[model samples]
Every structure is written in structure tokens, then in C-alpha cells.
Target: MTDAADAEVRDGRDLYVEHCASCHGAELQGQPEWRSPDKGGLYLAPPHDESGHTWQHDDSMLTDYITRGGQAVVDDMNVSFTSGMPDFGMVLTDSEITAILDYIKSTWPDRIRATQAQRSQDAWVD
Candidate 1:
């Protein structure tokens, strides 16, 4: 990779550690009991790794979720639910968000990455 791309991924890793590690985990392991909701009905942060459903989503949806937060997305879907995830729209710029996502994507295996890329492309086509 080029130096600039390397730098962006590094920056993304740093930003993710600073902003997301608390709930998501330093290694992106996510919180415990993440699939189950709490007593208050809020779901814990899910892993960003291959174990989780992050790879199932397209980039645009992921970007929207990051920018708008889980609650907004749930609300848009008209679901009666609450989200512990907070919006980063005001806190991070678009490119920074992209970098953070890139860093997360970098950890996935080749097959997963290709699948996600196709999903992203399909999203745009649809």
C-alpha cells in the first residue's frame, strides 16, 4: 500500500481506539452478551470482527449508522428499540469515519472483504 493509505489506516486505528474501543473492545471484540438486550432493552455493542454481522451490511448503511447512530436507524426502521451507540457525526468528519471503517475492514479475511465489497456495490446499484 502507499504511504498515504498506510497513514490513513493507522489514523483510523487510533481514532477507533480513542472513540470506539471502550464499548466495542480494543481488539473489536465488542461487549459481552452483545446479542441479548439489557434489562432496559438496549443491545450491547456487537463485535466488528467476522464473528459479528458487520460484514453483512453495505458501506452506505454502515456509514449512515456511524454518522447517525443506532437509535436513528432503528427509528427510521420504525422499530421500538433503543441503542447504546452514539452518533459521531458531530465528532468525526466523513473521511475520518471512512478511515475508521477502513481500519475495521482491514482486519477481515479476503473472502469477507470481497463479500462486503460486493454488498456495497449492490447497495449502490439498488
Candidate 2:
């Protein structure tokens, strides 16, 4: 990781606590029954851990989703899904967003991180 990312990851812990922990969980475990939809038919927030599919996404997708909000990103993709996640672009700086992602990536096991890194590379190649 770059020094800035290291610093962001370090600082992101507190930022996550303040902004993301309540819904995403203090341990990044996500909400209960996250795969199931609620009465309103919205799926609960998914985990950011190895058990979750967060690592399946490339960095640009992840960062864009965070910066633009899930709904907007989905809309841009012409996908027919609703996301309960709100936009953070108005609230967070680009560095802070990267920091939060770095923090989340920091939690993954090495193998998973490598896979995700490869996926990111593949995305760029495509």
C-alpha cells in the first residue's frame, strides 16, 4: 500500500466507526438477514468481510458506488435494483473515500486481497 493509503486506512477506522459502523456493523459484519429483502423489498446492507461479496468488485466499481451511491450507480448501469445506500459524495472527500475502501480492503485475508487485486487489473485491461 502507498503511504497515503496506509494513512487513509489508519484514519479510516475512526471514519468507519463514525459514519458506517451503525448499519454496516462495527466489525464490518453487516446487518442480519442481509441477503433477504425487508417488507419494502430492499435487501439489507451486505457485509464487507470475506463472507460477503464486497471483494468480488473492482476498486473503481467500489469507489464509484461509494462516491455516487448505490442507487445512482445501479441507475447508470441500467440495472433494475434498489439500493438503500445513500450518496457520500456530498459528505466525504475523495481521499476519505479511498481511505474507507483501504480500511475495508485491509480486513480481507491475503488470498482474497490478491484475487480482488487481480480482478481489478482485469477490469482495467477490459
Candidate 3:
């Protein structure tokens, strides 16, 4: 298997650390009490780790969330929940967003990754 040091993996790690680590945790642990809203009523960034629901979403949903911001994406899906994630569409290229997502997925356990991949495929089929 290719090592984590591969160019895309390295770039994904670097980009995630620079852009997403602060809110999401350097290790993708997310913030404390992430399920609950903050003092400002904003949901804290959720973990991208196996413990979180990030794996439950497909790639398109994840990409849309990163690119369109949580609110807009949620709005598009008519979801009732509020999303605190900011849209990175204007600031980052599609490739960059994909890189970050690749980094996030790289951390998941094999089972979780497989499940999530299935979800992504199912979403497209539906």
C-alpha cells in the first residue's frame, strides 16, 4: 500500500491542518460537546473521526457541505438542523476540498470507510 507520505496524502494533511484543524481539531477530534450548540447557538464543529457522523454522509454531501457551507447545503436538502461549517467554495478550489476530504477519510477505520463509501454510492444511486 502507498504510505501516508504520498503526495496527495501529504497535501491533504497540510491543507487540513492549515484550514480545518483549528475548529475540527488537529487530530480531527472536533470540539468538546460537539453535538451541542455553543454559547452563540452555533453547533460546534463535529469530529471527522470514526466517533462522529461524518462517515455517515456520502462524498457529494461532504463536498457540498465544504464548498457551499452548512447552511446553504442544509437549505438545499431542506434539513432542519443548523450547520456551523463555513463555505470554502470561494476560498478553495474543488481539488483542494477533495484533498481535505481525503485527509479526513484517511483517518477512519476500515469498516467505517467501507460503510461511508457505500453510503456515497447509495446516494448516487438514489
Candidate 4:
């Protein structure tokens, strides 16, 4: 890859650490009991690694979640629940958000990446 590409990947990692690591985990491991809701009925942050369902989503949906936050997205779907995720659209540019997501995608294995990429493509078609 070119130097500019390398820098962008580095920037993505840095952005993820700065904005997402606290809740998601420094290594993208996510919080404990992530599948379960807390007493207050809020779900914990799920892992971004291969073990989690991050790969199951398309890029556009993921982008919307990050840009608008889980609450707003779920609200749009008419889901009855609160989200712990915060909106980053005001704080981060669209490119920066993409960087963070790119960083997350970088961690997955080749098959996982391919699957997610296909999902993204399918989403565009749908």
C-alpha cells in the first residue's frame, strides 16, 4: 500500500481507540455479558471482532448506527429500548467514521471480511 493508505489505516485505528475503545474495548473485545440486557434494559456494547454480529450488518447500516447512535436507529425502527451508544456525527466527520469502521473491519479474518463486503454489496442492491 502507499504511504497515504498506510496513514489512513493508522488514522482509523487511532480514531477507533479514541472514540470507540472505551465502550467496545481496546482490542474490540466488547463488554462482558454483551448479549444480555442490564437491569435498566440497556444492552451492553457488542464486540466488533469475529465473535460478534458486527460482520452480519452492511456498511450503510453500520454507518448509520455510528453516525446517529443506536438509540436513534432503533427508534427509527420503532424498537422499544434505549441505547448506550452515543452519536458521533457531530464530533466526527463522515470520513472519520468510515475510518473507524475500516479499522474495525481490518481486524476480521479474510472470510469474514469477504462476507461482510458481500453483505454490503447486497445492501446496495436491495
Candidate of highest TM-score:
1
Tens digit of lDDT per residue, candidate 1, span 3-109? 99899999999999999999999999999999999998999999999999999999998999999998999899898778898999999999999999999999999
TM-scores across all candidates?
0.96, 0.92, 0.92, 0.94
> Per-residue lDDT of 46-89 in model 2, one digit per residue for the tens?
99999989999999999899888999998999987778888889
* Candidate number that wins on lDDT, 1 or 4: 1
Scanning candidate 1 in windows of ten residues, the lowest lDDT window is: 77-86
Give the range of the ten consecutive residues with the poorest summed lDDT in model 3. 1-10
State, as a TM-score between 0 and 1, how close model 1 is to the true structure.
0.96
Q: Which segments of model 1 are wrong by more than 4 Å?
A: none
Q: Give the whole-model CA lDDT for all candidates, comma-separated.
A: 0.94, 0.89, 0.89, 0.93
Q: For model 4, how does the per-residue alpha-carbon lDDT over 43-114 read when each residue is reduced to its tens digit? A: 999999999999999999999999999999999999987789999999999999888888889889999999
Candidate 1 displacement at residue 38 in angstroms: 0.8
* By lDDT: ranked, best first: 1, 4, 2, 3
Tens digit per residue, CA lDDT, model 3, 1-126: 377446777799999999999899999999999998777777889999999999999999999989989999888888777778999999889988888888888889999999999999999999
Best candidate according to lDDT: 1
lDDT of model number 2: 0.89
**How big is the positional error of residue 57 in model 3, measured in Å on the Cα after superposition?**
0.1
- For model 4, state the Cα shift of residue 71 in Å: 0.8
